[model samples]
Target chain A: MATVELTFSALPAHVRTARLVATAIARRTGVEESLLDEVRLAVGEACSRAVEAHRLHCPGEPIRIELRDDLGRFEVTVTDSAPSDELEQERELLRFDDPLGQLPDTLMTGFGIAVIVGLADDVQVYPSQKGMRIRMSWPAATNGLSPV
Target chain B: MDLKLDHHSEDRLTIVEVEGEIDVYTAPRLRELLIDLVNKGNFHLLVNMEKVDFLDSTGLGVLVGGLKRVRAHDGSLELVCTQERILKIFRITGLTKVFGIYASVEEAKEAHGRDK
Candidate 1:
């Protein structure tokens, strides 16, 4: 088991840095190329959302990212200040009304959240006084274990 | 990322081959490419994505915006996607119905050639 942690002052530039870190971690952990790509996309979406939340609501706050690899399972957790109660409530009530039974394409809605949930095997959200924490995980058993 | 621009006929059709990831970081380049192509009066656009590995919401937004911009000028935009993940994103987002997606660049070229 190996763990890597990084914290940044919630900026747009860190999005690319987070993806690069995930790629390096996946390479070091011997995760498969396809699975790594999935992880990268999932983590990228997660971090981008977190950054957006920080910028919009909790301005000037720091965002933390933790990556953990336990043999075949990889987990990424992003923590940032909680958004306003009104926005959180609004997000909770929002649902995709896709008439075609496909993912919703609402331009200003839960597109990033949908991407994170769809791409990751497990997703957990925890809200505390300190902030909100989002965690996404992938099981190597299902995604293959060969490194790219 | 490399973007190769090709023009067919007297500015009737434009082909842009995008090779790389299309995420938040790279979507600006795509947006610029689309804007440039549209500004040049080459509205019939086909984006060759055979080599693109990944795309995110930002990329999708750019494409959607590009389509709208092209349509505003009475032009059409098509896509040539062979990658499974990219195709899956398009399918999930219902963009396959919004854009003309062909199996290969050659097929897209052929279809566009017929339109000409």
Candidate 2:
């Protein structure tokens, strides 16, 4: 398994850089072209959220992202130093069948989580004392991300 | 890439042409432009997103905030989007039903006239 690691200050400018790097690695890992956009969007959303969290409370902190390509699975782990309570709240919100079912008002907000869920094959959220770790993965056994 | 925002007239509509990416970093620029247009009494807005390469939730929030701004003036905020990739984000977020998305600026203007 090969892994690419990235760490950057919690700045919005670095979000695109992160996306570009993630897409480059995902493509190299054999993630399908059709799903490239998904990887890009998912990474952007995750990075943006981390940046927001850091800017709010832990200014100047670094956000860490890991892109791992195993034999049959490719995964991204984004670790942010946002408040643990905020991360827990986000986890609870994800439990909703349709967090967007509320209304356009609420829909316009907290939309990134929904986007991540739709694009990734698997999503795992763990709120740690430091902050949150969002694990999103796509399997390559499908000739998509992981190789058989 | 960065977000490039420019506006022009299409019949009775004000078309904001967006290029490049829209994320948390650049979305505020878009929000400011949309709000500026509204503040200057330009309301019938149709955002032309043909060249928009990327859009995330923050970008959508800006669009929705613009919509609210125009709606208060009894005006409208629509979109000219033909890219299926961009459209899918709206669909997944349930925003496809909120904004009036057209394939071209002409169609959006035509639809605007009919609404009058």
Candidate 3:
């Protein structure tokens, strides 16, 4: 098993660093290059959301990212001190359907989470005293996962 | 992330080269650039995504937003998508039919040629 932990100051540069770490870990785990890109993109998006949440609700807080790989499976978790209601609202906003609406201009940017859920095998959300935790997993098989 | 902005024949064609992942975080930068270009009266756009590695819905939204803004002025937005992952995203989002997607920047230039 391999693990990497990083903490950032909820700043934009840290967000990019988190993505680079996830990409490197995904490549080290022998994940398909394309799948690795997808994983990295998901991690980046989730972390960005957390950073945005922290900036809005808990300024000056730190963002934590934990990535683990155990041969056939990979897990990425992003944590920050923010309200669960925001995450729930994000999830809800993404679930709405609007073929022609201005999704980008709105707060529906959480659509990245949906893409992550679609590409990964498992997605779990936990609200702790520390903050909201978002865990996403991908299996080696890469089969039977639902599309976003 | 590296963004290259070029203006060809004032108010006619503008090409933007984006090399990086276009997600929620990085998309704002692209949005600002594209919107600023449009606001400056440069409507026609050809986004060269040959070097772009990844794009999500936010990225898609940026493209869509640019398309709408350009079309509002009777202009058009074209794309040069060579990367497999980026192509897959366009195919999955049904945006392949929405934008004038070409195999290379050359083709995109050629298509814009006819438009001009």
Best by DockQ: 2
Q: Model 1: per-residue lDDT, tens digit, A1-148?
A: 5689998877766787898898778666666667777788778877776776777777688888998886577778988885635445545654444322222233422556667777788898675656778898876543334445
* Candidate closer to the true structure by DockQ (higher is better), 2 or 3: 2
List runs of model 3 lying over 4 Å from the truth. Answer: A90-100, A103-108, A126-131, A140-148, B9-11, B21-26, B56-58, B91-94, B109-116
Over B1-116, each residue of candidate 3 has an lDDT whose tens digit, in order, gives: 63334435423668788786676567788888889989998888888888786677767878888888988999888898877777766665556778888897777777777867
For candidate 3, give fnat to 2 decimals.
0.30
A103-148 per-residue lDDT for model 3 (tens digits): 5534334455555665666888786556788898776423321232
Tens-digit lDDT string for candidate 1 (B20-112):
777766677788888988998878888888878778766776787788888888888889887888886666656777889999767877887
- Angstrom error of the Cα, residue B77, model 2: value is 0.5
- lDDT string, candidate 2, B1-116, tens digits: 88898998766689999999999899999989998999999989999999999999889878888888898899899999999989988887778878899999878878899998
lDDT of each: 0.72, 0.83, 0.72
- Per-candidate TM-scores read 0.78, 0.89, 0.78
Worst 10 residues of 1 chain A by lDDT: A99-108
Please provide, for model 2 over A25-48, each residue's C-alpha lDDT reduced to its tens digit, 9 standing for 90 to 100.
Answer: 888788878888999999898888
Chain B TM-score per candidate, please. 0.87, 0.96, 0.89
Better of 1 and 3 by TM-score: 3
* DockQ pick, better of 1 and 2: 2
Residue A115 miss distance in model 1 (angstroms)? 1.8
